[model samples]
Target: MEKRRAALRLLPVLLGLALAPAAAPACEPALNGTRVESSRFVLSYQSTPIEVGKHFALDIAACSKPGAPEPESLKVDAQMPEHRHGMNYAAKVTKTGPQRWRAEGLLFHMPGRWELSFELRAGGTSDVMRNSLVVASAPVRFTEEEKRSILSHGPWPPKLVPDPSNRVSGNPEAIAFGERLFFEPRLSGTGSVLCATCHVPYRGFHDGRARGFGLEDVDRNTQSVVDARFNRWFGWDGANDSLWAQSIRPLLDPREMRSNATTVSRFIRNNPPFRTGYERAFGKKPPEDDEEVLVDVGKALAAFQETLVSGRTAFDDYRDALESNDVREMQKYPEDAKRGLKIFVGKGNCGLCHFGPRFTNGEFADTGIAFFARKGVVDPGRQGGIKKLRSSGLTLLGRFNDDPAQATALATLYVEAQHRNFGEFRVPTLRNVARTAPYMHDGSLATLRDVVRHYSELDEERLHGDGEKILKPLHLSEDEVSDLVAFLESLSAR
Candidate 1:
């Protein structure tokens, strides 16, 4: 009995030790010896552990040294450690009092863990404080009506509408000859620049520049050669109606290829390899006439450009897996990316503008980019394209085109309807968006996060001048924003 009582007494002592609190780790001092009065900052949201397709907010404040001037700017930023994605925070600041400021803003998109940092700056001094938060995923809810509407009707490998009179389809010899002409610098007037110089093979068949510089500065973004055959209209302004017609524009442009019909014809006639290739493709010797020779050159260049297609990406694989209900393949994708995909196709509403296999609908909208400033200095876009199409001699209506009849009709129709195409620009494919930074028509935004933030908090006032409505704010959480970016990166083939 006495031994049993002693054992019971020992059990209480052991339990007490197990329940004791752990010793706190020693706190490290700041580098500049600026003591932080209160390291804690509050970030409250509409929901805790935010879900996909939901909205949330972060509220932050930090206490600093006594008599410290208000921070010049109280900035907050976020990072997703798991996905290695982040964004610079854009918050509305409210002065709570001296040395205390509060920041509040929305986070839109999907669920994930996010690290938020507050940059408190006063006078010349600055300090950063950080905290972590978790956002949980939610169940997907789709309606039968919505599901039916999402079904894609467009044909895969997109239908190629070939001209019956041209007889150019599946002509291997013509394609091979065209490839040679495309890379040859001799096609240009200066002989210093080749077609490949502007239409690069690796970089989405486009040189990464806002405007191309050739014999002189050309004021227009370099259009991608990939999927040129799929386009109903060509160029940023949709100026050209046919591939053959579009090819001749750059050759004759004083600032671009700068080669007239006479110069181009003389060079091709003298080049033995080019002459042989042309004879094989056309079933005749190189054309003697300057106009005929220039037409043939344009045809050859178009043939080569039609072949640049994007390789399959992770998103394609995931999408196929989802459609097939292949749970095994679906599970293989990065979990965060999968969550991001749900947000992209659901709450983000990016699919409204960027849709289909190519991630573009081939339509135009005022994305609120600052293309035109003053009345005189305007980037007229489609307005200028309509004028150029009607006035230029190199258009499809000209005798130099391969299929003049069909090309001319299409060009005429566009010219007649020019008023409807104002302020419009072709929506570019987003296959390799991650590699090509500085998004939009003008290449203004520096990163994908910046682009998202722009759309997240877009103001209608900024878009007033363009006569277009601004994109509404998304109000996504920090974690959800990171997931959306993660999903976008998965679209890159690399």
Candidate 2:
């Protein structure tokens, strides 16, 4: 039994020896930094400020005591003792000199106390030495121009205004009725799906799927309705001019709820709870006309969704501080994020399209994403959106519009589809962006890092001839990528 145990132990050492490289690259002499000592050896390590989530390297050196054998191998590692988790990636160690080594690809993914370990193996024995480190973010000081650019992003939670085209837009009863309908599965033809299936409240109002699924898969990602009240146009293709009209599309689509106006109105009229709620919202019994009841139900849904605005975030506090010239308050923001903000407003040119408190221009643009839906099918995007908008009777210019003068209908009337608008899509709001993953209209990019990389190495050749002139390859360094991701994460609510 003892012999078997001894042989099993030797297996690991033999495997490690077989896996090691024939030669390790040379490194400079000992790093003159933090030093630690063991009974048989003195160890020293040097590294930059270990900020959370940023990758860094370590230079290490060991001095053996007189008459003691040098270590045959070495390994370095770090872990959070309290959380019982290590780094997402392992460090690659290389012996640089007789007593020096370099460890690369070390990253601390979270802010907390970490226990760093260095293992020395010699004469069939190993010694593990450890040191504790406290990691926190250090913010940078901003220049006058940078401060001005940062301040423009927000004072946050912008004041809500009632929609001029929806008479019951701000009514509490209408909002309550809409809330009930939002979760009512019987509103669908199959009585199995509801708005919450795709716009799940817990998942940042997103379904977290690459494409939405109701009765079947839809060709686009499920967008959040968190701040729908502030939108100028609705959907990725901007097919609907009003939120209520957009709400009605899913009800009628065969791939979604698959219910006609007659079925929807009959369900609302026959159900006691829905009937009572509709009466409270519309100030009367459910209407006899199916089309009128359907539009009213849509208006009620829009009223409730308008109240779903996101809360204030860290970026808002920093922007507010910058506006008032409160240096101390501004300093609380991360240094890497400040660097990212500079890139965003200046070199990145992102603010040109994603400016304002909502962090969007509320317009459409072609960002070079592929428009192919299948082998021979194209999504058509804004071009098709314009065609649908012009043909639909549920627009701001239609009879259902509550505005007497039709003040908001001008855009709907004047919007002509141009050849350049072929693959254009609505620019999404950036508020609470970190929470909404599987990004883009098709949900192709899976992470904020991936989205940043897409722009960093943008394929300018892939862009259409009429694409936005401001877009170009950023050629960002890895550090800059990390900084930008940090800045974007700051936009999320705490």
- Identify the candidate with maximal lDDT: 2
User: Candidate 2, which segments miss by more than 4 Å at Cα?
Assistant: 1-139
- Write candidate 2's Cα lDDT for 135-188 as tens digits: 875445557876677777877888778999999999999999999999999989
175-226, model 1: which lDDT tens digit per residue? 8888898888888889877787888877766777766777876656677777
lDDT of 1: 0.65
Q: What is the lDDT of residue 436 in candidate 1?
A: 62
Q: For model 2, what is the C-alpha lDDT against the true structure?
A: 0.88
User: Clashing pairs in model 2?
Assistant: 27-96, 139-335, 140-335
Which stretch of 10 consecutive residues in model 2 shows the poorest summed lDDT? 23-32
Give the per-residue Cα lDDT of candidate 1 at 123: 69
